[model samples]
Target: MITVLIRLLTLRAENVIPEVIWALMAIYVLAVLVTLTSVWVTFKKLEGRLLWSLIVLLVPFLGVIAHCLYCLTHADVDVLKQFGFFTRKTA
Candidate 1:
């Protein structure tokens, strides 16, 4: 098993860097789109323009994660209340 794993690792090392970079780029784009969708949905639900611009300007994957965490945990109950959408409720 160890020998097989070592062989596989050696083989993968030959082409893994480019493949990993491509995957990261794809994930980044997907994250950006998800963030944009989240912001749009949030705006549509809440009828406010508070964080959309700021979130969109951030680096994609990290930005989406940040926005999601903030929306889920922050104490802005009024926003969630106004939209009738809470993370816990959705879960």
Candidate 2:
């Protein structure tokens, strides 16, 4: 049994399975959907929401990846500050 397992593990595949490809595609689609939903929910203004939605929809995979990186880097700062979406309060 151990020899059989070792032989199977040592074998290399020449082609990917159709089911595996479909599963991967499905997962990617799901991720895009969830990311789009999060973008809509996170940005309150209509303009900001529309801009981000267009970005994610137009660029697909790269848009989501870029957005993820942007969020990670700016986790502590006001993301919409540059766009003048929010006004600063003076004490």
* All-Cα superposition RMSD per candidate: 8.4, 10.3
State the C-alpha lDDT per candidate. Answer: 0.65, 0.74
State the TM-score for model 1.
0.49
Candidate 2 residue-wise lDDT, 42-85, digit = tens:
77899988888788889969988977886666664476666665
Residue lDDT tens for model 1, 4-64: 4454467665544555567667878887777777777666644344466465565545667
C-alpha RMSD in Å of predicted model 1 compared with the true structure: 8.4
Error of 2 at 3 (Å): 18
Off by over 4 Å in 2: 1-14, 77-91
For candidate 2, give the lDDT of residue 58.
92
